[model samples]
Target: MKKLIFLLLAFLAACTSTETKKATSGSAVIINETVVASAMERIKTSQPGVDQTLLEKGIRHAASLWREEDGNPSDFIEFVKANYISDPVRRKEIFTKISNYMESVNGHFNDITLDLKKNLDEAAGEIDQIDQMYGNYSVGSHLSDDFFSNKIAFAIALNFPYYPLAEKEKLGPGWSREEWAMARLGDLFVSRVPANLNQALNTALGNCDMYIAEYNICMGKLRNEEGKQLFPDDMVLLSHWNLRDELKANYANKENGIEKQEMIATVMERIINQDIPEVVINDPDYEWYPFSNKVMQNGKAIEAAREPDTRYDLIVKTFRAMKDIDPYNPEMNTAMMRKFSWEMEISQEE
Candidate 1:
């Protein structure tokens, strides 16, 4: 589930508006350093005694992310003045409202997906290729586009600026829930991923998920050295989670437990390594012997080539597509790091 969610949102930062990078840290800024410095000075001069340090930080941070679509320096300054909530109480109130709205939207979208794709997702009925494709389609791909177009993204960035993982780690322990929520809100607009790339990512992930869904190991057709079936006729395990879980479940049956576990492990390794034969996967027509590395059909040994590294290829595809967004996300560049440290709130060391 986390993997699926990451597939959806991790690419979101890459799908920003076509406003182009103006004041990004690396790029030669259209809104140059001088322009930004002047804007900050103006804000500071205009709003005296308004947490000068925070005001400076917010202005600079927002300027760094500001694009051509977000308006010029004067417009940026005015937006900063209007939207930057100075009072902690008022800021918290706004954050709470936004948080509640976000929760509601997310919850409803989740429910809609679950309900709409019940046939394909829940394994309830015969789902064709079309059904599968439709089920895997993303619902929230355009969310970033909409938010940024409406200046909601700018508003959030101006008020609750982002903190990198390192900073969060150092300061997070003492932070209240609202402060943490503010940090999370800051997390959204850190980078903008193009919508097309996000669509590609969604398509790639959806295909991988569909492949996994159809990848079932017929347990009853699995044979050992003596050509004896170890599992019940109706038993089937989906790769690789269910198959792995079945392997773990055999621990109590000491008689053949280790052997069964070893066989399942071997199957998993073959799948992961892309050595599993194309004919035996999800097809009960062929009985497979993991130990002997053979496939038998109609009780006769037949030659079949190994799978074309589709499983491993998808993993690579996912990583490559995700890695494309690393440059955009300065804090948690890699998707794995983002998943663990940012989204799951678990540090790498932990």
Candidate 2:
């Protein structure tokens, strides 16, 4: 039976892996090599003494992001011709303007997000279902689509092409402040993840956050094997960070320190195994004995059901949400790859 179960699990794993690869493999490359080549040649011919390397990289990167909705080959060619800055002074001026504009746009978006998340993140007041919905709504979710529609993204991509982490590490030392800023600016608009997917991802993560925020263990209601309360009546701790911290702090309590740590360890184990009583979480009305896995209420023992794998369910939902975004990001298709290569500027192999 165990062998058969193992084989079944392996089959499922293979199926999931195959699905992920299939999803990511279909990232549409609409702009063919011929279009890219023609666009580069036309721009170079039109503007004499232009930087050959920049011209090639910028045009190719812009072409990689262009879609049918953006326009035809001729339209792309015209855009490159019109937007590619050849003169050093003119390029700097344009860079400054774009930088300022992006700063303002990003700043306002951040302000809006903070305001939206105020009730969720803080202990200001009671959070309703509407508050959760508002918190999950991402104001900047459609920003990428809007930028693409306005041709601002294309303009930025044409002027400032993205550099991979390895390339940036190699060329970073000699670059001036302005050049560094331009390279950073080029990092935007590399992917075209849809707004709906972005919102879904946000909601999934927000739900997880809310679950964690509400996961408080009433320490005051905990009892040891002898039915003795070790903690104060008002003590409460949130798992798993606060619980771990409390365990660490208890090491200094020479008296019953090991006992407290053992109880805390038992609580953590129960949480991980999903054997924690659902009623005991965030409820001070019940007394829980971690060592015996028993619960009592109103001075009498009572029956309670264990948590029904809600923690693991939330985790799987978040993972699938992140995976849904993989197709839009052709270069860093996986969330792990994006975290290491794009966000952290470090390759996964390292």
Candidate 3:
């Protein structure tokens, strides 16, 4: 028994060692969660403090999209990378396809939102119709809320790498159950993100929850609850291994920076001012919120957009603030710039 136990321990040690070797040799580190975690690690360990600013911005957007949707981080990462194929022509083709797909989903979502709002409005004005839609206390609004949960969420599961023609034909057009899935998949083909994926995500902004939910279900990455419960659907898990905490931490910093930029700026101001009263505000002990850089306009930077209308719009938005900053600046060629804008806008009609 002692001899057998010694042999078994040796066997287990060898197997564990082999597994670790295989992982280090073959694994690729990637994910929405992983991106955040890895980014934070790089920032933390930088020998000379690498600029993590871009990573932060990208991760913030990723977190918003990730938190509000459902799908495997792996699948999403795959989709993002694959669509960025090197061949320019092929890249354009894939992007255009994704763009149209997004348009279809967006249009559908908009129509649904408008129709529901109208129905609720009518019900509110009429007690008779109220029974039809508003019978249960605020059930009418609840129905709309449920619709958002179901329909308005982003569903980005795609099926774009062409399967064989035979496989395509297996999905024959019909009024059968399998055909229903085929029809839904057909919409997937139609919703292409134009030119690039960021645009596609923008286009799919208000729709595609079903696709996102379905992808999560397939990858077994579904969260128990999130968003407005925007994504809820059946999914299958193909493999095991989860997004690392370090990655998620990267995105967490991103989230904090984006929503709290003003606060960060205000802290910097107080630290610079060094006044006793401001010290209370500056106390890093409290959630030291400095006025964010969002409000602090850059005079030189604003002047550098190289287009009058762009400058005009900036001036218009921060007119009160900009006026104070550059009081000596002469009036811009408002008429010529507007003409230049009109002509440039008209040129696009071609």
Candidate 4:
């Protein structure tokens, strides 16, 4: 279930706002304060009795996302004038329409992804390179770009401006259901990452998932001191989740539980340090003594190669992929910041 969730997240991460041709960071303020004030005043003059604070916030937010292709300051003012909604009834109707459209788009894309990932996620026979490619491919990757190109994203941003996490935490209790939904919708187009970068991140995470899925420890082959197997024959567990779960379960076993726990710990340490025998990993042909890090095959001890830091290599690959996205995200420049502040809606200190 965790693996499936990870896979799903990897696919969804590819659906961020599409990159602009300029390649500037989203954090850079494109519209100046003068233009923002002018746009806000123009909207106020056009629509009498409009909420001044919300109008300014919405105009500024929309202007921040405007690019060279999106037109100049005069065009931006015109866009705000045209798209800004002052009437409550009309605003609600538009919000509902946008919500329904987004739901349909997201649902169909998710269905397509699930179908593509079936072979990789399920025990549906041998997985080919094509399966991996399809599983890693994100159908919604270009949705952001298309929306921005058509000015749909800008329209949404203009009316439904985003609130900071701190601001939300403070005022969320007083917000209505529609307000909450609008806030979430505002979050959809905060930054524009390139489609290629999103695809690279998806591939990196998918490769990590594949590596972990195939990493199984043959517990029946793990021999302790005095040449005894603690686990039953044919007992196999995936590392490190299953291995950790089995170790926790052994705590109830008063007899030989400590020995089993120690053996599992040793196995974990070997895995972390990249000294685990290559032949013992997902291979039942060799007998492994975790305590001494020894490998024996058919009653004869043999020199076995270590895992060559493949674990760390994959981790680095995923890290680099995330790092490549940092410059595009002005608010959350680092991956950790995005995970905690943007995704988790909390600070690491909290």
Predicted structure with the largest TM-score when compared to the true one: 2
User: Between which residue pairs do clashes occur in model 1?
Assistant: 13-192, 13-193, 14-192, 14-193, 14-194, 15-193, 15-194, 16-193
Report the Cα lDDT for residue 15, model 1. Answer: 52
Candidate 3 lDDT tens digits, 1-350: 57975785465434432323333322222245565565445444542343354334333333333322334565444433332233436534645665676577667766665664453334245334343232222212232223224432122222222222233446444346633443333333211111222222222321222112211112121111121111113323211111122223334565443333332233334333332122222112111112321111221212111112322233233322222212111111122332332223222211
In the range 1-350, model 4's lDDT, one tens digit per residue, is 57975885686455443443234544355689999989988888999999888888788778877876778889888888999998889988999999999999999999999999999889899888898889889898788778888899999989988787877889899999988998898898877676778888889998988888789999999999788999988899999999999999999999999999999999999998889999899999999999898899999999999998888778867876786777677667778888887898885752
- 191, model 1: CA deviation in Å? 1.5
Instruction: Write the number of the candidate with greater lDDT, choosing between 1 and 2.
Output: 2
TM-score for model 1? 0.85
lDDT of each model, Cα atoms only? 0.76, 0.87, 0.31, 0.85
Better of 1 and 4 by lDDT: 4
Sorted on TM-score, highest at the top, how do the candidates line up? 2, 4, 1, 3
Query: Considering lDDT, where higher is better, how would the candidates rank from best to worst?
Result: 2, 4, 1, 3
Q: All candidates' TM-scores?
A: 0.85, 0.91, 0.21, 0.90
lDDT of 1 by residue, 162-182 (tens): 787788889999999878889
Q: Worst lDDT window (10 residues) for model 1?
A: 20-29
Better of 3 and 4 by lDDT: 4
Instruction: At residue 172, give the lDDT of candidate 3.
Output: 42
TM-score-wise, the better of 2 and 3 is 2
